[model samples]
Target: MATQSPFPFLDGLFERIAQGPRPPDWLVNEAQQRLVLLINHVLMQERAATERLIPRKGRVVRVQWRQFFVALQVTPAGLFDLAAQGGTPDLRFEVTETSPLGLAQAALRGDRPPVRIDGAVDFAGDLQWLADNLRWDIEDDMARVIGDVPAHTIASVARSAAQALRGFVRKSGAAAGGAVAPWSGNGPLP
Candidate 1:
């Protein structure tokens, strides 16, 4: 848990979106921000879990863009497009992305997403620009979103949630028990 700043930007963004005519520039910025954070968090967990499952040896099969992953589908581990740079995938799998907080609330009520995996990750130094940095340690929601194929809708939703969480984390800090930055330590993002 880390402290965050109030995401007045996101709040205002959302408010603007909700208000009426949408601004194209605002929407584009929102989409980029959304993808950056969603991909980062998922990859963060995926990285941790993968490290534990795949033994460090000669080399783990680097899943290409369309490689066979799950038992049923011949697909990549997660959702990806041909435009997405990488070796051609062998297969594809469905993905349903539940927000961290949303998933927790769901668990409390006993309403579970078809598949679920959990992990505690230290995400202090992760960047949002790496393609091969997905976290496999956490459960892949891919298989759960769609029955036989990766759903584009889920990816979109996941991206949105990721952006919102990024905004929240940026605005708020770790609860009351985590790390603390100095008043002047908040200089600028590296």
Candidate 2:
């Protein structure tokens, strides 16, 4: 039996919105700046992440998703600086999935969105290492400003909320006749 989408109207609405006019350049730049700021904050937690990129200083890496793109250059300080000129990229990553719904589903299942890569093998390896090892400890960062006790309590609640949300998503997916792939180990791929 063929299963129908639980929210066909939402699916169509998303498609239409995605096809609509792009945001202004300034807005896009602001969004990119905010994203970079967040990434830098996360990077601050792991000194080794920046240190590994030191040798790649001045190298440009371009990452693209849908119509949004950010070109960043590795600085001598080992952090990323936006390259407004967008000179030739030493490494480029383009997200293959175009549909917002599909990407959201993948994320809910803790799966990585497929990406097309174009870059030096060594740089790519280093990037992969950074991805695999470095993780932002949001609770630890919060504790720095809010004190350990409150931060721990907040983090615990946040974690529980996240787990509940993930469970809801999985159940909704299954009820819709869709399989939610596991992040790792066992379970069939969607």
Candidate 3:
């Protein structure tokens, strides 16, 4: 039950794993990166659920930022030999006393490239789009997984990616721009 990607570009992604005799590092990176994004998404979902929102729509699982960040850290457990390219935390974010404008200027000079977290970020527009596109889908998906089967946010679904995907779907009825965080609902930002 591999979830059908909302974006068609991803269809070829999983299939690439078997095409070459030697698995591509890109494939490994892709899978590992997906896992990392999944980690972040689930963390956010768990938090949202605890806050008693819809409890289940997730759309941010495709970001590559985590790959850039996680590549810097190695697995503490030497069991499956992992790759660590960056420092401990892959994404390096620091609180600064600088003004927003000044901070933006300094961040422009920060190390990015493989460590993609330092890239210029525009949250306002993206948040608005997420609210419109994913809001209802997230809630409905949450109901199916966390509601009926009770899969914990971090767990990889009921079992494999297939089963997990069975519980995931895009809500057709959900309007675009409904994925509102509590802050968007006139609450304080977390």
Model 2 residue 16 CA deviation in Å: 8.0
Give the per-residue lDDT digits (tens) of candidate 3, residues 93-147: 3333223333332333331233223322432233233444432235446666667
Judged by lDDT against the true structure, how good is candidate 1?
0.37
Which lDDT tens digits does candidate 1 get at residues 1-190? 9766587467477656544564476664465456545644564455553343233212112221111121211113332212233433223222243344444434433354333222212221111123235443222455554532455556667768877755544444354233222235476632
**Per-residue error (Å), model 2, residue 38:** 2.0
lDDT of 1 at 174: 55
- As for model 2, its CA RMSD to the true structure in angstroms is 8.4
Best-fitting candidate, scored by lDDT? 2
In angstroms, the error of model 2 at 110 is: 1.0
Off by over 4 Å in 1: 1-150, 174-190
Residue 141 local lDDT, model 1: 54
Which segments of candidate 2 are over 4 A away from where they belong?
Answer: 1-17, 175-177, 180-190
Look at candidate 3 and tell me the lDDT of residue 33.
68
TM-score of each: 0.21, 0.78, 0.21
lDDT over C-alpha atoms for residue 156 of model 2: 100
Instruction: Judging by TM-score, tell me the better candidate of 1 and 3.
Output: 3
TM-score of 2: 0.78
Q: Can you give the lDDT of residue 9 in candidate 2? A: 75
